[model samples]
Target: MNGDWLLRGRDGRLTVYLPSGEAVLCRAERGPGGPWEDAPRTVGGTQKLHPGAAVGQGADRYAHLAAWRPTVPGESGLVHTTHFRPLLAPLDWVPIGHPDKKGDRTGPPAVAVDGPGRGYVFVRNAGGGVSLRNQKVKGGWGGWLDLGGQEIEERLAPVAAESGRVELYACAPGAILHWHQEGDGKKPVRAAEVEAAVRPGTLRALATSAEHTTVFFTDDSGDVCAWRPGEKPVPLLAAAGPGPVSAVRCVIEGHDCTVLAQRSASGRVAFAAYPTEQESAGAWWTESGPQLPSDALVAVALDEHEELVAASLSPSTGTLLLTRRKDEPGLALEAWREI
Candidate 1:
């Protein structure tokens, strides 16, 4: 799946979810350091789901999954499922219908949960603008609200900052569109747009501060660039890789750092680590593990031990492969193991 597949729960557990056949299958660790469960658990009532799934976790420790499914023949609608406990059980899939009633047309969805545990889902609408739906205070959901934009790409990046404010980023024809909350409990309004030619399906955002986030994406020339709300785009690495890049912030050697992973042109998972938000300081990409079979989606997250964990689905075999960051040096990872 293009969206995040690796999730770290508030209880210090890691769970991986992926699309299997027409259902979403997940596997999670028994406890913190993980002797992960052997077989995959089928999320109840997701047999008709589409291929990709995007997952997000909230402050309440609930994991939210978003996917699209056929509501009627030739028409599709958004479906969501929430997990009360990690790897235990997920509630039934709830339908959040499309923004347009004439025809159920929407792109893949991305979800983010605010600090107070309310969840928000975003997708590109039929007219190529962004639309959002969020969880109400008492329960249930609010109606779909169109956050206007045009020619937006399918891949969306949504991140909730430490201030409990949610921010969204989308790639358009020749620029990146941004939206954010002005105050607590406020809906995100369209903000400044960055002029950059971003490659489709490559936008990724990481919250680098309490109120702001830094977005990373490959520019039209295949170079990786980092940009924040007010700052200019900072070019980080050139010819980094293909497909979307995965990143997570953590403490390394007592210094706040951001670690990134992407699929290299040679089919290997490459890694880079740098001081958080200091892209101009310079960072190098290093190829890690053996080359993957093809353009497998690579993802990274910090485990309970605060070590970096990278995961990807084996496109050739449909197996999940995982590797952890080595304790030694800059962004090194242990050997890859399948589960």
Candidate 2:
């Protein structure tokens, strides 16, 4: 199978979702850079599954997952878990929403968690509309609500701001469209589009601060561009990588930092970081990581200790490789080690 994986590491464990509808959960007893003492366990392989997305609820020690599936024949829908703990699996997955019988899901659904452990799922319908579902604080899930936009492309990703606002982004014919319910529940969904000069691939969003929420994507020109709130898109790296890019917000050295990882056309996978404490749009990107196979799928995240870890999937051999980087007192860039 042509597999896609979404990985998340937190609270001394890593959760990996395979395209075949299986989730492999691992526990890192010696921490992220150490060996996974427990044997990885797999769950849920009965149905066809799309790639999955995950987000952690800060301080609650819980993570939420959302993945698209055809639970019923000819019906494209979403399966999710609200009280998911990576180290503990065999979850009771719940069906939240589905497309109309005449319509189908156009792409993978994205998931994000707010400060209160509330989860949000965003998916694009075949009719070119974006559908969203929210997990209520008390219990159960809310109904599928239309965010309302025309010509919204198939692929979309959701990012939850620290301020409890969730933003959804999609690429259109000539620009990228973003929709969000900014304030209270009564407000209508706000929509905006940035006229980017390049086509986007694998879009990722991060709410860096109250002042700046950024979206990063791989452009058609094999470069990484950042789109800040209310501003035009700018190039973060000029032709730095090929293939795909992944970005996440994490705490690094007591400051909130944006970590970007990419695989180049030459089969080399590397990462860069931009700290929020710095004020330059022309920020420097530090590269550190072992090279991965050209065909490998890559993912990056911070462990419980806030250290950086990168993982790659070699589909041909079914091998998953992980690399970890440690920051020292005076080191500019630390070396990456395979775990």
Candidate 3:
């Protein structure tokens, strides 16, 4: 689907979810040192998922998945599934319904989990506005709350800051709309919009500090740009390719770094690392391994050993490919291994 296919749980396990035909199948590692399961396990009741799916892990360490199902009889809508444990068993796909009933129109969802382990799902409503539904403290879901915006694009990025406040970013026609919570467990209030021409489906958010997050997206020129809440947008890498860029924060050489991965224009996964929020320092983009299919999605995360791990789906072969950062040098990755 997109780059949100990989998830790292609080227990140090990594799970890779892929949309195979009509179902969303997953394979997770056994423990910290994982040889992932030999075969894929189908998430229960996900037989009608629309290929685009988003996943996030809550404070309870459970993986929450949101997907759009467009062919569900009379009214097409969105569905959600949560893993009961870290190892990928006991999943039930529950329908979350759609906001617009006339055309049953809804975009792919973006999920975020607050500090209290409640999950929130966001999507572009039929009227080109943003709508959100979240879980209550007692584990019940609230109704869809329209978080007002106009001409919003299909891609959405949501990040839960280290302080447990969740912030959302959406790309509108000529601006980037923002929504944030004043404090943890509070409703997200819309903030002033940032004017920028961002490429649709290329927005990603990473928490760089306790209360602030840096959002990265491909600009109109195909260059990657970084923007924080109240700061000017800083251009980073140039011509870094398309689709959603994935990022994870880790410590490298005793320095905190943000590592990024995206599918390059040449059909390969490219990576870059720079000091967190220090965009002016410049970043070196490196293309790793052989070329995957152009539609392949890339995701990066930290493993139990604190090593950087990257995963992607091979849509043509219906297999998952994985690689880890090499210890010897700068931004090097071990060979890609199919799982």
Task: For model 2, give the 10-residue run with minimal summed lDDT.
Answer: 1-10
What is the overall TM-score of model 1 with all chains considered together?
A: 0.96
Please name the candidate that would achieve the greatest TM-score relative to the true structure. 1
Candidate 1 global lDDT: 0.83
Which segments of candidate 3 are over 4 A away from where they belong? 70-74, 101-103
In model 2, the runs with Cα more than 4 Å from the true position are 1-10, 21-33, 44-61, 101-103, 184-188, 250-256, 277-291, 329-339
Ranking by TM-score: 1, 3, 2
> Model 3: C-alpha RMSD to truth?
1.8
| Cα lDDT tens digits for candidate 1, 1-339 | 645678877788888887787888878888987789888788756458877677887767678888888777888888788876666788888888887753665788899888888878898899889999888877889888889999889889998887878899998888988999897657799998889988888899888977579899999898999989888898899755778789999887788999889888888888888899888778888988777778477899888888889997775577678898788866667889887
Clashing pairs in 2: none
- The residue pairs found clashing in candidate 1 are none
Q: How high is the lDDT of residue 36 in model 1?
A: 91
In terms of lDDT, which candidate is strongest? 1
Q: What is the C-alpha RMSD of each candidate to the true structure, in Å?
A: 1.5, 3.7, 1.8
Error of 2 at 113 (Å): 1.4
In order, what lDDT does every prediction score? 0.83, 0.60, 0.81
